[model samples]
Target: MPTTLRRSLLAVLATAFLGAAPSMAMAGVNPPTVDDNLDPGSSIHVTKTVSTPVIPPRPDVVLVVDSTGSMGPAIANVQSQLSTIVSSVKAAQADAQFAVADYKDVSDGASVFTVRSDLTGDPAAAQAAINAISAGGGGDGPEAQLNALWQIGAGGNRISFRPGSSRVVVWFGDASGHDPSLGHTLADAVTSLQGVSAKVVAINVAGGDGLNATGQATAVTSATGGQFFPSVAAGNLSQAILEGLTNLPVTVTAETACDPGLSVSFSLSLPRTVQSGSDLVLEETISVAPDARQGSTLTCTTRFKLNGADAGDEFVQRVAIGVNDVTPPTVACGPGVNPSGRTPGGWQQAGFFQMVADDNLAGVSVAIRDDATGTSFGPYAPGTYFKLTQAPGRSGSTAVPFTGAVDWHFGFRGDATLVATDAAGNTASATCSVPPAQK
Candidate 1:
């Protein structure tokens, strides 16, 4: 984006980006991130990654807790912030499904170590469950955190993660958790979590457990490839948990490709970092050379950290450009006799032109060419040819006043060629030959 952007080579993207509006935002973005040294004769193939995982418009999240007596403040905080938190999460993931599973140490002996709520799309329902949870338990230092993880993380069927959904497990509490005693070790917890590929985001509420509690949470998350939050070691437990859930990581990629002679830019006006559920567009521009052939096709592709990342499924855009000038322009001529402005046929020499959007006709450009002698001339002068007024069919007519006769120079012939080209690389050409010999 901070490179020398050459504008002329990107004619193709002007139209293609407009056509692919659904897939991306029209922001300034560079597909290759850098574009100055690209080869002009080569096909363009640049990819730009978004770098942040788009928040799943609706993600499936399960809150597994270490609900013990000290958990009162943590659970209450969750209740107070539940609405705002869900609202914020829903802003990015409108269809976010939230469920809860509260667990105390198995040593707590039958006091509701594991309580599961079915996933619900309604934020209100999720908030209600969060508000209803109570922090009450008496046991050893460790809680049945892993067993709770086992039930849901192992796809225990009590909670179902939707298909094509991001799997997240958020757990918070004020104390440490035990690895064994529930008939399963820490490895068992890791294996269960692997079943669903759920990232276990652990929150050591209020720094109460000191190192041991955070250690257990860290071990589980590390085994599962989930991330551990900042080392601030303390904060509002509710804020910490929400931040872990909503501010997820991501990988983004954008690719802009084209045929030779066409320049493609993937990040014309695109953001380097995009948050989840943002309706932003990654703009791409493709320009073609003046001499590029007509009827050519072009493409743009973008891949993300997760496949199928485009909000509207607009991962790629392709189009065919039409070229003008398939045939030479037609030129009609009759030279005047003896250069006296008098034709033997009594008709003045002239040229006629037509093009698309006939009513919007602009005068055409023509230079004289002698086929036999290989010479070309003019940008003819005003009185040499006059444009027609209110012409028919987007047309223009002009008279060429020259020579006294059609064959003034005894068999000399002047073939006039007319060429017309349009904005989309379409060109038309025609040649009219003045007959040789006297007419």
Candidate 2:
């Protein structure tokens, strides 16, 4: 099979084993598992990639309806479908919350813009507030829409939105808002909405000079990071609300945390904003401290956020690091000295020489190998290893060539290598040469 097709099939099979469809975005760390025999004072890097979801979740929606005389049917429709809308949003995001508010003309009474309910997770409370709204008095062609928005958005968060949530105002009406409604102009409304991070989904109902009758809906929605749906039927308001929430624009960013022994740095100057569903690649350099003990493990996690809200564990990537020792022990062999004399059996007597081995972490053994004779000698421990013993008057001046060792004649005729091994299996060697009995 082709490489791409095979990978796709593997992904499908893996998702199937998990008993779920691939409906949500996921994040991953490249080379997820790191096992290395690294020397002390060394480091490595890991790549973490995070992708944003298609929808911004944890919506905090506020229904800002125009409760004018002509808006009875629209108000009633929303009240009836409030439960369904809540269920749909909760299905997409379990932490969704809702609120209710309405606006009428200032000329009618002192209750021009009233917040019926604060933002809450209780759908029943929001529905009760919407049900209590009686569309009765709205004088003239325009209502106090701008005033209502100002109160909800810039009026000190009159709706009490959750910090880190996607703020939305589902506003609908059949009439345009009064310019400078209750001392607040269109520009003031837009600025206030943006300040509170609120996105307006303006649904202009049909059968009258709508909210966009004078194009104010278009201006407000565009300037506040929202959408404008003109001439929508009063009955189809619920579906439009659902569509608005799903299609809402969101910003993505990344954050990282690591264990004490490990330090991490990223390639991107976070929190860098990215579009929804876009791939964000971050090169994370994970370094183990130079003084970190061998045979230890380090870990780090990279998490994602959507519009400043935590995107949960599904959008997190974790890395595990293993540290091992790779430094070899040091080995040195003393110079050769000629044999003192020959034995009666015509065998050369043993000469003295020393082999020293040192390791950074201790616990080392020393061994010797005769290159010319292909013979091996003792793998002696620290104190038991051979050492040079000078005869009387045979000081450093008369230290001639030697036939070394007792059993296998190491460095007997040619050169020999002294090897040292540490407890971690790291090895080092040094050569020792003996002249052939000085001719």
Candidate 3:
């Protein structure tokens, strides 16, 4: 089977499972004590929420191509298609910036070569660089992919977008150079690149049997939330790159109410207008009052209207709703001293952290992470908080306790973010930071 066909099948299977599953219940699970749910207060008492489509920000791209003796034909093909790729990307997103890096053997070693430092919106420069590359190097040593990835991740001259732009590193190679042990080095480089919100896309040009190619692409892409195109050739490389650039769906959860018969509606706001061929999936939950029907069918439809045109904007999707009999859980957190400064024992000593996320239909789970180390902590134990009588006056709050004499010397150097996920995998996160202790 073709690689694209396999991916398509997998996606279809996943979607089929999601649709066939029973409508998730939001009640019975305990509500958090602090009412920390990020969405506006819920009245229908939905247990879970999840999103179907997620569009990411504009990306900065770095094109890394292999320039080996055997790659003469492939290299030439890539050079010819360079203009088309740039134009397509620009058409999709105007802010996209690009850079080129070609690797060939220099006097010092095989992997060493020249890198153009300037990044631009100009397609001419990219094309020029592509045309200038020569594929004649003696040492057939594997391409220095690890080193190149590291350099790109470290924000070398190849990637030059301003801060905050999404960064994407696209690596193209024809043969296996280094062993999988280089994965650690690749991962570290990717990690640094991610610090700037950049991801790595590996496109292996190795044809014939795709044994090592697939594995290499997977290693790099998995580490950076990017994609791997194994066995891709110069002919299909541009398309592969574009497909990889498209953002995947993001999960979102909102709280709203609906009567047994009345249709409840919600709208998804996009960061920008949706492109013509692009489509979005709308995932939702309609929770009924406690004494409502158990096996009712809830209908859902997605409408895309321009300027409030009812005719053009309406598209419908439906699902069967199932009732959950279990009682909702309650959530709670800290009665102890708040960590004013960095706790001497790091995050482990933050005390018993707890929160209750309840849904009359679906229920919820919460996760916490330390922003400084990018370390994730937990789905803290439940039942330490109180349920809202009628949607508490405020959102939610959670407390982290600091024990012993506060070490003013090592104050909080980073942020701790808390995220709550419902049964539907809908999530909301809140960030709190301990101020740096006085010197």
Query: Relative to the true structure, how large is the alpha-carbon lDDT of every model?
Result: 0.51, 0.69, 0.48
The lDDT of model 2 is 0.69
Give residue 58's lDDT in candidate 3 (0 to 100). 47
Write down the TM-score of every candidate.
0.57, 0.72, 0.45
lDDT of 1: 0.51
Per-residue lDDT of 89-122 in model 1, one digit per residue for the tens?
5654566788987887676677545554678887
**In candidate 1, how many Å is residue 420 off?**
12
Where in model 1 is the C-alpha error above 4 Å? 1-41, 45-57, 109-113, 155-157, 207-214, 229-235, 253-294, 300-439
lDDT of 2 by residue, 205-224 (tens): 89778899778899988887
Which number leads on TM-score? 2
- Give one digit per residue, the lDDT tens place, for model 3 in 111-163: 46456634677889878877877776626455555556655665343456566
Ranking by TM-score: 2, 1, 3
Segments in model 2 whose C-alpha atoms lie over 4 Å from true places: 1-51, 258-298, 322-328, 334-355, 358-367, 375-384, 387-414, 421-427, 433-439
Residue 98 deviation, candidate 1, in Å? 1.1
